[model samples]
Target: MKVLLLICVLALTACTKESEELRMRVQQSIPVPATMSQVLNRGILYPTAGIQVTGVVRVVQLSSGKQLQIDSFSITPGPDLKVYLSQNALPGNHLNLGNLISNNGHQAYNIPANTNLSAYNYVLIHCQQFNHLFSYGKLQ
Candidate 1:
């Protein structure tokens, strides 16, 4: 009986350690805006432009009717790009290139269903002039 109890305790301890390690990895990889103007203007000799996050996204709720959110991230190009989100991996649910704004760095939409509340995963981000993609994991 004592041997069985000891084995069970050891198994539980191992599980706890594994969980802690996973949490650390998730926290370390939260995606922020990537500065890519130099790559965008490699050939041109024009003045350098700045890219910034224009809008703030505190929390994006995903419910039945609230499936999509059109977050605007504008660039100096004078066009506002729209980012779309869906609940599933269907035609309209994934993130792509055409939705990204040229100069603005928006935190893209968060699809609640696709996100893992327990762990971090990648989400789709889109823009117009550039179809840039990024990853963001679950936050505590």
Candidate 2:
């Protein structure tokens, strides 16, 4: 029994170490037209329990449409992470912007032209597989 417990502990530690080293880096700089040089709303991201998140999130007006931009962003690596534009800080009643591109970097998600920013004003990083809220930022 002692040997089995030791094995379990070792396995858990190995898994944690592996996850820490596996960071997916991404960069997506969406170009805004020179004429449309406006940031309609912006906010700072805050981490949730057991997570570390740092970033400036903003809504930029574009010639084509609006975009949710994350700059100088980094987050604790997790499986099945997704980007969401939510009505609340929590996950319910949200727009699934799609899978998070990376654990760290500048990334952008296009906001549908029809989306009402006043209603869905909170940006969230969620773990869809586990239904976990990793971080959130409310646009003001």
Model 1, position 56, has a per-residue lDDT of 26
- Model 1 C-alpha lDDT per residue in residues 7-40, reported as the tens digit of each score: 9999888843458778898556433333231111
TM-scores for every candidate against the unseen true structure: 0.25, 0.75
Clashing pairs in 2: none
Per-residue accuracy of model 2 over 10-115 as CA lDDT, tens digit each = 9888743334224332222433223344899999999999999999899888878888888889999989999999999999899998888778888778888998
Which stretches of candidate 1 lie above 4 Å from their native place? 1-49, 65-74, 78-98, 101-112, 117-140
Clash count, predicted structure 1? 10
Q: Distance (Å) between predicted and true CA of 50, model 1?
A: 2.0
Cα lDDT of model 2 overall? 0.85
RMSD of 1: 18.8
Backbone clash count, each prediction separately: 10, 0
